[model samples]
Every structure is written in C-alpha cells, then in structure tokens.
Target: MTEKTAETKVTEAQRAALGLAQLSEDERRRGLLSIADAIDEHHEEILEANERDVTAGEELLAAGEYSQALVDRLKLSASKLDSISEMVRSVAHQDDPLEKTLAARRLDEGLDLYKVAVPIGVVGTVFESRPDALVQIAALCLKSGNAVILKGGSEASHSNRVLYELIREATAELPDGWAQLVEAREDVDALLEMDDSIDLLMPRGSSEFVRYIQNNTSIPVLGHTEGICHVYVDEAADLEMASDVAYDAKVQYPAVCNAVETLLVHEDVAEEFLPEIAARYEQAGVELRGDDATREIVEEAEAATEDDWSTEYGDLVLSIKVVDSLEAALDHITTYGSKHTESIVTDDDERASRFMRSLDSASVFHNASTRFSDGYRFGLGAEVGISTGKIHARGPVGLEGLTTYKYHLEGDGHVVASYAGDDVKPYLHEELEAEWTPGDRSDE
Candidate 1:
C-alpha cells in the first residue's frame, strides 16, 4: 500500500476547495440550499450516527475520561439536527457575499477600478465535540464560495463523518471534493503546517487547545482563545432586572462559550443583589466563588482566588466580585477578561452608553445577558465562529467574515506612462457607482 502523507491529503483538499471557489454566486447559493435539503432528508441517518458517538461518549464519561460538559456538547438531538438544517437554509437566503463591489473609482478616461468581495480560497476549521459545527462550516463556506476542510473531535467522529458525507454528497455536483473531512488526530498537525494551501484556520475548543493550534500553524487563525465573559450590575440597575439577567446569562446554558462565568456587582447593590442572586444560583446548582466583599454578602460562596477571575469555567460555576464603581468593574474586566463578551445592567442611559463604549470586548452589551452574543441570535443567518481577533472579523463571523476582497481594474489601452511625465494627462480620481455584472473581467 502506498503510504499517504499528510501533505498529499491537504494538497488534494486544497485543490478541491479552489475548484469550488470558481463557482458563481448563484450556483453557490443553490448548492447551500441543496445541502440543507439533504440534511433534512437524511436526518435519521445522522441521528443514528450521533447515537453511536453519544453512547461511546457516555462510556468515556462513566470512566471519568470526559467531563459532563463535553458529553453535553457531543450529544446531538433531533432538534439540534433540525436547527442545523435550518441554519443552512438561512445561509442560502442571505444576500450573496461574493463579487459585491465595495468601492469604485474612475482613474482616467476609460479606466475604472473596483474593490470587490471575493472568497478567501480555502478554509480549514478544527472544532470539538459538536458534530453540528461540521454542517455549519460547510454551509457557510459553500455560500461564501470557499472550500473547507473540517476536522472534528474524535469523540464525535461517527456523527461528524455522517454529516460530512451528507454535505459532500449534496455538493458533489458543484465541485469535486468541495468539502473534506480529516478525522485523525495527527492530521491536525499536518493541516496546521499547510499554510501555503489553507488561507484561514478556525479552531474552536479550549483556550489551551486554541493556543496550541495558533502556535503550531502559520495559517491565519480566527477564533477566541477563551470566553471569560462577564455581567456587571451597576448601582443604578433595577435590582430585579439585574438579578434576572445575571441568572439567565449563567444558568440558561452553562456549558457554552457565551455563558457568563463572572458576575460583578456594585458596592451599593452588592448587599442587596448578591444574596438574591446567590439564592437563585443555589437553586440552579451553580457553585459561586466570590471575592471578599461578595463573600461577606453571600456566606455560602467560597472565597475566589486570583485565578478564578481569568478562568473560563465552562460549567455550572461562576465567580462573583464586588466593585466600588463601574470604573472599578471595567478595570477588573480589562485585567481578567478574555475580550470575548461583556454586559452591563444599568437604568441610566449615560452610564450604560459609557460601559458599552469603554469595554473593549468583541461583543459588549447594555441591560442584556452576555448570552446574547451569538451568531444566530445576531441574525447573520449562521456564524462560522465568534472572532475575538481585531484584524479580519471581530464579532460573530458570518459569510462576510469568510470572504476577502480583490482589486479589479478595467481600462482600454490605458497606461500609467500617460500620467507620469511633464505635459502628461491629468489623472482623474473620481468616485463612481459600479456593480459587478457577469462576464465583467478586469482584463476587459
């Protein structure tokens, strides 16, 4: 048997992704819709595969090899599969993200320039547990006219493989191997080294795992390392509303990345709000760790350590703190936050505005739970991931984030020499309204 090298597999996948990129926007959209339909039609098959993975995961959990949170993330219910299908349909309904003219300028007579959106070529994503992510990534990549290589965690290997097979079959007519799946753990190292072939890398997992991927890969990564999200209850906040928001942020879905792991209460409200929220947390079986001031109010709260402020405890655990003022809260967030999500509960508009503006996280909120910082809830149809990085995309990365732009210059025998020397033609740098029409090539 010929030994297949990692480089060989990546090269093959990249070639397929590039081929998919050549598809027209309309074709890409159709392909996405087709995949969605296929998912709906084959839901049972996917569920069957998911059950196998879940059963295996339960055994691992019983053996103490996996956390309950990992088991929760790995399980795929029928509703989740349905939601995944709907998300694919939503991506198809969105406006085509390719070839949109972002800017147009008339350089000179018969010479025009255009900045247009285009696909980012090949995208490589390594995600954990959630097999549904495989569908989301493939749909978003197809809609944006990019090829994708997905590597999901081994725990969900069966489910991921089934979903990948469905997506590949649906997209088979468009471009050969438009979606590729790599399941081997060793392939991750190989994929990271293929920077020349992969344009972007998105790793979704633990902080340490994301860091490991970033350290090993030369490919540009677009993901947050951790989500140490927080919700601050301002002194002027309505105590009832603040308590409700804080509770929802932590208790609604404690295992996800967007869940709030820290709660900051103002000194004025700490005496009243801490005990109330603590009672609520206790009802939900959430363990509360607090600072000195917070511990004084909630006697049951264990004393929080410095490390508690920075940890992303993706479980039913929360760290609480009491600050003298909003500024103190902001300082604490600045020092310990992962720049993922932060929320403030305040009735005062000025203070709310200030908090929203001053916080430097990717998604900042006022009078809302940190849980609202989601791609689907934000209405990007679906998100590839939440990006904390500042360069390409900042918040929920949808189809727009999956794309880059190209400069398209059009001219009829126009030369730069005409505008260079003395007595040269005057260059006209006038803005013009332009749209990309089919068959409009730069060479034209």
Candidate 2:
C-alpha cells in the first residue's frame, strides 16, 4: 500500500497502434454491429462466466454485506445478454448524430461559422453490477466518435471482462483504438489521474460515488447524483388513469432511478384517492408511508416523516403526502424531489401544461408512468445514464448526450478585420423562408 508498483503508460507509438475508435462513422457502426453478432455467437461462454461471478457474489449477499436485490442485479440473465445484442443493433442503425450541423451563421463575407459534432475524445464510465452498461457506454461512445474506458464493479468483473473481450475483438477491425477495458480494481487511482488520458468521466451508482467523482475531477461529468423522483396526482386528474400511472410508476420497476419514490395528491382528490391508491400499492407489495393527512384517509398507511419524504429508497417503499393545492404539490417537489424524473397524472391540458412548466425535473411526464423515463422508451437508441443534472445533458442520455460542439469555420481568406472595419455595416440577418433542413452527408 505504501509505494505503488511501477506504473506502465501507453507509449505514443503504442497508443497510435492500439486502434480504439477513430474510424469513419460507417466503420464504427460496422464494428459495433459485428460485436452484436459476436455476442450472439459467443453467448454460452459469456453466460458461464457470468454464472461464476454470480455464484461468488452469493457469499457477499449471505453476510448481509450486499442486498439480495443488488446481487440479483449483478448477475446477467439469458434475456439480458440478448438485450445487449439488441442494443448494439439499436445503436448501430440509428440516425447519425454527427451528421447534422446544429448551427450555421455567416460570421463575415467569407468566414462562416459552422458548428459541427465532435467526439468527447475519450470516456471513462464507473458503474455497479449492471453488466449491460459495458456494451452501452462502449457503443454510445463509438457511434458518437469517441473512445471509452469502462470499469464495472468486481461483482460482475468476470462477466464484464468477457463482454469487453467480445467488444474488443469485434471492434479490432478499426484501425484506431476505439475501446479499452481497465480490468483491475487497483487501476481506479490511475483512472482518476487519467485527466490527461480520459476526457469525460461518468459514474452510475450511489449518490456518494457520483458525488465523489464530481468533487475529485475537474473533467466535466454528465450524470445523475441520485433518483429521488416523484409523481403528483393533480386535482383535475382522471381517477382511473392517475391511479394506473401512479401505481405503475412506483411498482413496475421499484429498484430503478425513474421509479416513483414520492406521491403527492391534491386535497380535492386526497380523500377519495388515497385509499384507492393505497389498496393498489398493497396489492403490488409496496410499503406505503403516508403523511398525517394521507394517513387520515388511508388508515393502514404507516405515518410518513420528513426523513421519509426526502429518502430515495430503491425498494418497495413509497412516501405519500396530501397537498391543499397544485401550488403546494409543486412547492413540495421543488423542495424535496431529486430533480430526476416526475409526472402529473392530470387530464386537464392547462393543469398538465402548467405543472410541466413549473416542475424543474429532467423528464416531466403527463399522465404517463414515470418508469417510462428510459432511453429505448423515449426512442433513444441507447443510453449511458439517466442524467438528473442540468449542465451538459439531462434526462435519458443517449449518443447525443456524450458529445460537445466545436466551431468549424469555412473562410475564404477573409479576416475578422472585415467585421471590425469602421466602413462596414453588419447586415441584419433574416430567417430563410423555406423549411430548414440539414442536407444529409452521413449517407454520402
């Protein structure tokens, strides 16, 4: 622990030879598609390796050191391996994000400002037992024109390593290094020091871990620190639809970031709605923790406290509060909610519109399950993380989330002096009358 083993660095020549993903977009997509084929072809070896990792993870579970749910998530299932292959195809065939010029302006007579898409260069992702993240982060970065270094937890190390091998072998067709896996847990320190090597770092797990990486690195991070999501059943809501959306949001996938952790009902509906919703949660095995007002209506609910309202229990746990008005619901959420994803199960267009505008969350749904806050559901080909933060990216982070734009100037020997000259009057700009369309270059 005192002195580290002699560090090895990628030599300039070695780095050039180790082709990661600096290929043409077509080349990158072909590489990723081949990975999907390889994964399907080598499914048995991957599963056997994953089984061994899960078996060892059982010891960690029996000691009460790790939750059984967490251990379960650590293991890859038959269907999930299939999902990885599907994601690879999904990302491969999607529209090219890099093809579009997001903005274009005539800066001068000849100097034109063309904002073009560029890669984040190199990425590092730190996540827990979710082995699928291996393919996700890799595929996302590759398609978006960047390389990635993935670090999955030790619980799923064997599975992760095997997956990495498939991706590496599949993407080896690239003349440039497109993806790399840092296998050892001890490599984390060197990872942090890789500000020079890595461009952006995204950590997906606990709030503490995300916060630690955020505080430690000066490199920009795009991720959610936590998922204390909420769902507010407004006064004008349709009783049946509201109940269905709320119940599904909380109970469908109770252990994910988008699962509803808190529910707020307006006073107009609280009396009739609380008991109805409580019964549904009971049927779904959800533990309802209610505030005094909610308890008065739903007698069986355990009393909710300030702590319960603020807590993000990624289990069958929910906190309910009764609000006198829509304003109160918004106020409560603005105060305690995690700014992750939230929804208003209201039929009234005005109310839904107002609530959507007022609530400051990444994805604000209207009469829909909060659980639908996902990449595939939103038609995003794949997602690296569900970002709750507001800076670079927010909501379901797909390929579009991982990149930043740089100004590409096409100048015909014109200088900024042309604009700075006293004789020159800057021409007022006008919108083009025709429907604006970016000419397709990716296909060409």
How well is each residue in 338-436 modelled by candidate 1, as lDDT tens digits? 899999999999999988899889999988998888878888888888888898998889989999999888777877788888878887888887675
Q: Where is model 1 more than 4 Å wrong at Cα?
A: 1-5, 438-444
Candidate 2 clash pair list? 19-176, 19-177, 20-176, 20-177, 20-178, 21-177, 21-178
Index of the highest-lDDT prediction: 1
How many clashes (backbone atoms < 3 Å, residues ≥3 apart in a chain or on different chains) does model 1 have?
0
TM-score of candidate 2 on Cα atoms, chains taken together: 0.89
- What does candidate 2's lDDT look like per residue over 1-444, in tens digits? 453221232222125323432456787789889989999998899999999888888987888787765776777777888998998899998887774577766544444555676666777788887788888888887788776767788889899989988887887667444566666767766677656666788889888888878877777777656788888998898988899999998888777788899999998998888888899999988888998888888888899988997888888899999999888988999999888888998879998888999988899989889898888778788899988888788899998887777766555675656566778767433222221133321211
Q: Per-model C-alpha lDDT, please?
A: 0.87, 0.78
